[model samples]
Target: MAYTTLGDTGLDVSRLCLGCMNFGSERSWMMNDRDASVDLIHEALDLGINFLDTANVYSTGESEEIVGDAVASANRDELVLATKVFGEMRDGPNGSGLSRKHILDQVEASLDRLGTDYIDLYQIHRWDDDTPIEETLAALDHLVETGRVRYIGASTMTAYQFTKALYTSDIEDYSRFACMQPEYSAVARHEEANLLEVCEAEGVGVIPWSPLAGGFLTGKYERDGDPTDGTRGAASESVRGYFIEENWDVLDEIRALAEAKGATPAQVALAWLLHREVVDAPIIGPRSSEHLRENVGAVSVDLSDEEAARIEAPKTPRWPAAGKD
Candidate 1:
C-alpha cells in the first residue's frame, strides 16, 4: 500500500481510501451487515489501507457506527479516519446544508457515530447554495481550532466555488480546504477542464470518488444490453448515467489495455488515476473482501504515458461553460 500526504498537510494516508458507503443494515443497496462490515474493515487495514471515509448521512449514520465498531481494535494512530457533513441527518431545516448550525451539529453527531473524538479530515459533502460560505468556513475553522477536526475538505463542487472557499479562508485566517473529492476516472475526466489544474496549482490534494465510473469502467456491463441485475448501475439512475456510448468506447480501450497488461479493467482504470501527479488517492467502496483485495492491487499497476493517453483519449467534450477547446 503506497502512502502519500493528505493534500498540503503532513498527515499520511493510503493511496486507496476505503469508502464506507457500502456498510450498514438500513439500506438494502448496502450489502454489508455488521459482521461483514467489520471483516472488510479488518481486511482493508490488513492490506495497509489506513484512510477510511464515511459520511454522516450514509445509511442515515448507521454506516459510521459500523465503521466505528469495525476499527475499534486497530491502532487508532495509524488510521486517517474521515467523514463528511452537509447532509440531512434528521427532520427539520437544521438537519442539512453548510449552515453554521448544520456543520457544528453534524460534526458532533458524526464523531459520536464514528466512535472517535477527532476526525482526521472532515469534508463538506457538497456546495451549500443556501448558506453563506463565510459562515460555513468560520464554523469549520472553529472545529479545527477546537481539535474536533484535524483538517477540512470539499467535494464535487465547481472550481469557482472551491476557489472562493479557499480565498475566504485565507482572507479570514480560517481553516482552508486542504483537499478535493471529485468524480474522476478514465470514463469521467470532466474535472480536467479546470478543477484538476486548479488543485494542482493551488497545492490542494485531489482524492476522487467513483474512480471506476461506478463500476462502468470495470467492463462488467454490456454495451448492447441492460446492466446486470442487482448491480448499482442497474438499480440507480445516477450510476446508470454512465451507460452512454462514448463511455463504452472508453471502456473498450480500457479493456484492451487491461488485457495487454495482465490486469483487471478496474485496476487499469484506478492505475490511470494513481499515476497522475495531482491525485492523492482514489476512494474505493467495495461491498466484499474480494473486491477490496482486487482494488488494492491497483496501487502496483503502473501505466506508461502512452497507455494512459490511450485510456483517456476518448473523453467527451466538457460543457461549453468551461470554455476549453
Candidate 2:
C-alpha cells in the first residue's frame, strides 16, 4: 500500500500495482471469475493499492471493462487506473497499431469500456512498427490535451525503440511516455541492456512486469522434482528455458537467503525489486487472495545486503533491467 512517484509523471502510485491481465477470461489464464475479480479489486483497494494496470488488447478489452466497473464504486480519487492501446482490437487491416485512427478510436473505446471519463495513464502496449512514431505521439498528446489521458507510457519496448520515442517526443513537442513496462525478475535480467540506463537518463519511471519471472522465483519448480504440474511455472516455456542447470545452485543460494530472512522465496524476490533504486512499482499478479497477501507482505519484509547479494542472476551490467522499485 506504500505509494511512490510514478516516473516523471509526478503521480503517486502504489509500490505494488494490481495487474488485471486476468480480469477478463479470454485473454488470461488465471483471471476469469467476475465475482472473484471484483473481490480481488476491492481487496487491492482495501490494501491501499491504488494503481491498476490493464490493456485494451487484454481479452480483447474485457480486462479494461472489468476494471472500470470494479473500481467505479470505489473512491475515484483514491485510484490510479492505467490501460494501453496499439494492438489489434479486432480482425481488420486497421484493427491495431498506433496510427492516429487506431489510437484515437481505442482511447474512446477504452474510456467508455472502463466507464471513466479520463484515464490516469494511457500507454502503447507495444511498439507499432507499421505506424510512424510521430503519428502515435501526436495522437497521445491529443488525448492529454483533451483530458482523456493524464500521462502516456510505452510497454515492452526495446532500448532503441524507447530511446527513439523519447527523442521524438523531445523534438516534436508531443506526448511522450513517462514510464517503461518491461519484464524483470531474479531469473530474467535481459532488460539490463541499455534500456535501464536510458530510462535512468531520460527520467522515465520504471514499472516492471513479472517481477517474479512468471513464478520462477516462487521457488517451487526444482530441477530435482517432478517437472510437470500445469502450474504457471511448469506451463511456461520461458520458465522451462530459464530453468537451467546452473540455476539450481543459484536457487539454493536464494533458498538460503529466504530462510535467513524468515520469508518465502517470493517475498524475498519481490522485496529485492521493491528496494531496487530504478524500479518505481513492481507489478504483482497473484492467482488468489492468499497469494496476493503473501506477495503484499514482501513490502515490509526487509532483506539484508548479504542475503540480497546471494541471489543467482546474470552478472551485473549484463542486465541491470530486472529490479523495479
Candidate 3:
C-alpha cells in the first residue's frame, strides 16, 4: 500500500482507508458480521492499511470499541487513526452538533471507546448549522493544543458550510480542517459543483467514501440482473435491492472499460478517483476479508485516458455527492 501525505500537514496515510462504520452496534442493521469485521480489520492492517475510519455514532460507539480492540497491540505511530463526531448520541440538543460541550465531551468519549489517548484526524461527521463555526473551531483548536487531537477535518458538508469553515479558520487562527470527507463515486458526482474546487485550491485532502457506490460498481450485479437477491441483497432487500436498470447501464460501461484494462469494475472506479488531483484517498468499506483484498487490488489497477474517459458521470441519482462532474 502506497502512503500519501494528507495535504501539506505531513501526516502520511494509505491511499486506501478502511472505514469501520460496521465495527460495533451500527453493525446491527448494517453489519451483523462482527467476526468478519474483526478479521478484516486485522488483515487490512497486515496489508499495510494504516488508516482506519470510524465514527462515534457507528453502531452507537460499539464500532469504536470493536476497532479499539482490533489494533490494541499495534504501535500507535505506525497507524493513522481517524473518527468522526457531530451525530446525535443523546436525545437532548446538547448531545449533538459541534458545540464546545459536545465536542469536548465526545472527544474523550471517543478516546475512551477507541482505547487511545489522542485521535490522529478528528472530523466533524457533519456540519452543525446551529452552532457558530468559530465556536466549533475554537473547541477543535483547543483539542489540538491539549494533545487530544492531532488534526481536524470535516465530512458530508455542503459547499457553503465548508467555505465558512475555511474563512473562520483563517480569520480566527484556529486549526484549519486538514481534509474533507464526502461521498464520491462514478455514480455519485454531486460534489463537483463547488466542494471539489475549494478543496483543490485550499489543499484539503479529499477522502472519498463509497467509491464503489455502495457496491454498485463492483460488477457483481452485472449478471443475474442484481446482487440485491439472496445473500448479497440482505443489506438492501428492497424491490430493486439497491440495483436498478439505469445503474446497470452505467455499471455496464465501467465493466467494459475494466475488461479492456484487465481489471474489475470496482478497481477501475476507484482508480478514476485516485487519479483525480483533488482526491487524497478513497475510503473502501468492505464486509469481508475477500472484499478487502479486492478493494486493495484496485491500488495496482491503472486507467488510461480513454478508459478513464469512458467512465464518466451518468444521469443517475447521486448518493455520495462528492464526485460531481
Candidate 4:
C-alpha cells in the first residue's frame, strides 16, 4: 500500500484505489449484496487502501449507500472518499450534466448517501457539453468554498476541454481540477495522446478507471476461443469494444510478462500503470476477496524498464492524424 500525494494536493491516497462500482444490488451485473460489500470494504481497509472511488450513477446511488454503511466503522479522517456527479439521477432537464443545479443538488444527495460531511474528491463523471464550463467551475468552486467538497476532478474528457476548464479556474480564482479519471489500461492507451500529457504537465493526478480494460487485460478472455464463463467480458457489452486483434497482441505480451515475473496478468496490467510517471493510482473494482487481494498485490509487482516497454509495444497511435515523426 504505497501512498502518495494526489497530484499537487497534499491529500494522501493509496496507489490502488478501491472502486465501488461493483458493490450495489442485483441491478448491477457485477454487484454484491450489502453484507458482502461491507466485508469487501473491511478487507480493503485492512489491506491499507484508504482511497475509495464511486459514482452517483452506479446502481442508481445504491452503491453509495452501501459504501456509506460499509465505511461507517472505519476512521473517517484517514480515508480519502471520492464520488462523481453526472448521469441522469432523476427526471427533468436539470437532472444531469454539470449545470449549477445538477452539481449543487447532486453534491448534497451524494453527501447524504455517503454519510459524510465532505467529499475528498468530487468529480464530474464526464464533460457536459450542454452547460458552459464557467458555470460548472463556479458551482464547483462554491462547493470547495462551502466545504462540501475538498478537491475537484474530471473524467473522460478531451485534453482541450480539460485545459479550458483549468484555464477558467485559474482566471476566475476557482477550485482547479486536482485529478483526472481516464480510461487507461494495457490494452487501451488512447489517453497517451494529449490528455495524459496535459495532466502530467499541469500536475493533475491521473486515477484511471478500468485499468484492466474491462477484464480484457486479466488474461481471462481468449483470442481464438470463447470468454471464460461468468466473467464480465462474457456477459457484458462493454468488453466487446476491446476484443480486437491489436489488444489481443498486447495481452499476449502482458501474459508472457506476467508468467516470467510470477504475477497474475491483472497484477502485471496494474503494475504497468503504477510504473508510469503520470499515473497516481489505478482504480480496481474487485467483486470478491480473491480479486481484491490479487489487485492489491500489484503494488509490489515492480516492472523493469524492458518489461514495461515490451508490454506497451503494441500500442497504436492514439491520434492517428497527429502522427509521430
Candidate 5:
C-alpha cells in the first residue's frame, strides 16, 4: 500500500482508506457478518492499509466495534483511525446533526465503540444547516484541544459551506478541517466544478468516497440488463442513477484501458483516482477479501496522461477545462 500525508497535515495515511460502512447488517448489501468483517479488516491491515474510515451511524456503531476488534491485536500507534458524526444515531432529541451537544455525546460513544481514546480524524458526515457552523466548529475544536480528535474534516457539502467553515476556523482559532471526503470518481466529476477547486486552493487533502462510482466504473452492471442479484446496485436506488448511457460510455473507455494494461476495470477505475493530484486517498469499501485485494492492486497500476484522459473523455466535465469557454 502507498502512504501519504493526509492533505497538508503530517499525519501519514494509506493512499486507499479502508471504508468500514459495509461491515454492518443495516443494509441488504452489507457484509452483515461480524467475524467476516473483522477478518477483512485484518487482511487490509496486513496489506499495509493503516487508515480506516467508519461512522457512528453505520450499523449503529457495529462497524466501529468490528474495526476496534480487528485492530485490537495490531499495533495501535501505527493506524490512522477515522469516524464521522452528523448522522442520526438515535431517535428524537439530540439524535443527529453537528450541534455541540450531539458532537460531545457522539465523540465519547465513538471512542467507546472503537476502543480508542483518540480519533485520528473525525469528520462531519454532511453539512448541518440546522446548527450554526460556529457551534459545530467550536465543538470540533474542543475535541482537538481535549485530545479526543487529532484532526477534523468534512464530507459532502457545497463549496460555499466548506469555505465558510474553513474561514470560521481561521478566525475563531478552531481546529480547521484538514481534509475532505467528496464523492469523486471517473463517472462522478461534479465536484470538479467548485468544491474541488476550493479544496485545491485551500490546501485541503481530499479522500474521495465511492471512487468506483458505486461499482458502475467496474463494469459489474450490464448496460442493457438490471443489476445482478445481491449487488449494491441491485439494492440501492442511488446506485441505479449511474445506469444512464453516459456512464456506460465511461465504463467502455475504462474497460478498453484495463484490457490494454492487463488489469481489472475496477483497478483501472481506482487508478484514475490515484492519478489525481488532489486525491490523497480514495476510500475503498470491499466486502470480501477478494475485492479488497483487487482494489489494493490499483496502487501499482500506473496510468499515462493519455490513458487517464481517455477514461475521462466519455463524461463531460462539470467544470470547463482551462482555456475553454
Candidate 6:
C-alpha cells in the first residue's frame, strides 16, 4: 500500500482510504453483519491500508463502532482514523449542522464510538448554510487546539464557500481545512472546473469519494441493460445518473484500458484519480475482502498521461456535477 502525506502536512496516509459507510445496517445494500464488517476492515489493515474514513451519520454511528471493534488490536499510533460531522445525529434542533453545539457534542460521541481519544482527521460532511462559517471554523479550531482532532477537512461544497472558509481560517487563526473529500471520478469531473483549482492553489489535500462513480466506471452496469438488483445504480437515483451517453463512453475507454493493462476496470478507474496531481487519496468503500484487495491494487497500476487523458476525453468538465450541492 503506497502512502502519501495529507497535503501540506507531514501526516502519512494510505493512497486509498477505507470508507466505513458500508459497515452498518442502515441500508439494504450495507454489510449488516457486524462480524463481517469487522473482518473486512481487518483485511484492509492487513493489506497495509492505514487510513479509515467514517462519519457519525453513517448508520447513525454503527459504522464507527464497527471500525473501533475492528481496529481494537491494531497499532493505534500507525493508523490515520478520520470521521465527519454536520449530519443529523439525532432528532430536533441541535441534531446536526456545524454549529458549535453540534460540533462539540458530536466529537465526544464519535470518539466514544471509535474508541479513540483523538481523531487523525475530522471533516464536515457537507456545507452548513444555516451556521456561520466562523462558528464552525472556531469550533473545529478548538478541537485541534484541544488535541481532540489533529486536522480538519470539508466535503462537497461550492468553490466560493470553500475559499471563504479558508480565508476565514487565515484571518481568524482557526484550524484550516487540510483536506477535501469531493465526489470525483473518471466520469464525475465537476471538481476540475473550480473546487479542485482552489484546493491546488491552497495546497489542500483531496481524498475523493465515489472514485468509481458509484460503480459506473466498474463496467458492471450497461447502457442498454437494467441495473443488477442490489447494486447502487439500481437504488440510488444519484448513482443512476451516471447512466448517460458520455459516462458510458468514458467507461468504454476505461474498460479497454483495463483489459490492455491486465487490470480490473475498478482499478483502472481508481488509478485515473490517483494520476491527478491534486488528489492525495481516493476513498474506497469495499463490501468484501476481495473488493478491498482489488481496490488496493490501484496503487500499482501506473497510468501514463495519454492513458489518463483517454479516460477524461469522453466527459467535459462542469461545475456542480450532477447531484452535487
Best by lDDT: 6
lDDT of 5 at 36: 91
Put down candidate 4 lDDT per residue, 106-154, tens digits, no spaces: 9999999999999999999999989999999999999999999999999
Q: Which residue runs does candidate 5 get wrong by more than 4 Å?
A: 319-325
Candidate 3 Cα misplacement greater than 4 A, ranges:
27-29, 222-227, 230-246, 313-325
Question: Which structure among the candidates has the greatest TM-score?
Answer: 6
> Against the true structure, what is each candidate's TM-score?
0.96, 0.93, 0.91, 0.96, 0.97, 0.98
Error of 1 at 80 (Å): 0.4
Residue 289 alpha-carbon offset, candidate 6, angstroms: 1.2
Q: Please, what are the lDDT tens digits per residue for candidate 1 over residues 1-325?
A: 9999987889899999999888976655787568888898999999999999989889899989998998888999999999998878888868789999888888888898888899999999999999999999999999999999999999988889999999999999999899999888877777887588889989999999988877887888898888778888788787778777777778899899899989999999999999899999999988887788889999999999999888777775473322211
When superposed on Cα atoms, how far off is each prediction in RMSD?
2.1, 2.7, 2.9, 2.3, 2.9, 1.2
> How many steric overlaps does candidate 6 have?
0
lDDT for model 3, on a 0 to 1 scale?
Answer: 0.82
On a 0 to 100 scale, what is the lDDT of residue 157 in model 5? 88
User: Which regions of candidate 2 are displaced past 4 Å?
Assistant: 312-325
Q: Which should have the higher TM-score, number 1 or number 6?
A: 6
The C-alpha lDDT values of all candidates are 0.87, 0.82, 0.82, 0.90, 0.91, 0.93
lDDT per residue as tens, model 3, 1-325: 9889997689999999999875664433456666766777899999999999999998788888888888888888989899999989889778888899999999999999989999999999998879888899999999999999999999887788899999989998999999999878776677876577788888889999878876768876655643444443445543133365555666788888888878788888898888787888899988777788988988898877766666664544342432322
Q: TM-score of model 1 relative to the true fold?
A: 0.96
Cα error, candidate 5, residue 119 (Å): 0.4
User: How many residue pairs clash in all the candidates, one count each?
Assistant: 0, 7, 6, 0, 0, 0
Q: For model 5, what is the alpha-carbon lDDT of residue 35?
A: 93
Model 5 RMSD, rounded to 1 decimal: 2.9
- Residue 91 CA displacement from its true place in model 1, Å: 1.6
- Give the lDDT of residue 207 in candidate 4: 98
